[model samples]
Target: MSEKINVGDKAPDFELIKPDGSTFRLQNQLKETNVVLYFYPKDNTPGCTKQACEFRDQYEVFKEHEAEVVGISADSSDSHDEFERSHRLPFVLLSDTGNKVRNLFGVPRKFGIIPGRVTYVIDKDGIVRYIFNSMTKPLEHVKNALEVLKNIEKK
Candidate 1:
């Protein structure tokens, strides 16, 4: 496992496949707006779904703060497409096949099995400002991210 990414660290740039099969590069996104990069375990799962829906519900708020939400998981592009469509998620969902990005960020695995749930609030400058990691309280990820973005906006 790589070193765990921490607040104040520059977020590592990476490319992943979006639901539409287009490329998503983190560095390119940072040039436009702040990013709420969330790593979840799976698609269609209960906790993951609720977390995603909460993000969808607050997506406009994020935009108001000049942040863009992006979700990543080991699921495939087709699964991401279905999840986004079914949940009406306004943000992009990226397919992190083989959990490469997950490991890159050193996101933990629960019980040495389940993939961890983590949210990284990254500023437009590509600096990570906050990180929330919780396997049980999925919805808190959304709340925490919004709080961080609000704080970032105040600065």
Candidate 2:
């Protein structure tokens, strides 16, 4: 794996495909708002569903703070589309094929198999403000990201 991106490091810019097949560039997004970039394992899974719903539930609050919630997974665009429509997820879900972007962010695998559950809070300037990595406590990612976005807003 590449060197893990830390709190103070600049978030690496990457391009991925959204469920609608539109391209999503990280740097381009940072120009408009802070990004809550999350990498989950799969679509329609138990833990991933809960985490996405949590973000969906608090999405307006994130928007109030000028942050955008984005989810990434190795799943295909079709799967992401279904997940979003099924749960009514308001944020964007990008398809990270081959785990390229996940590797770019250095998200580790749990026990060398499952993809890591990690959330990164990147400020408007593209600096990573916070990183929460926890495979077991998936719901905590949303809470922690909101807290970080709040702190970033205060600054």
Clashes of each: 0, 0
Models 1 onward score TM values of 0.97, 0.98
Clashing pairs in model 2, backbone N/Cα/C closer than 3 A: none
Write down the TM-score for model 1: 0.97
* lDDT computed for candidate 2: 0.93
CA lDDT, every model vs. true structure: 0.93, 0.93
Compose the digit string of candidate 2's lDDT tens values, residues 20-130: 778899999999999999999999999999999999999999999999999999998999999999999999999887888899889999999999999999999999999
For model 1, the superposed segments whose C-alpha errors exceed 4 Å read none
Single out the weakest 10-residue window by summed lDDT for candidate 1: 15-24
lDDT of 2 at 4: 89
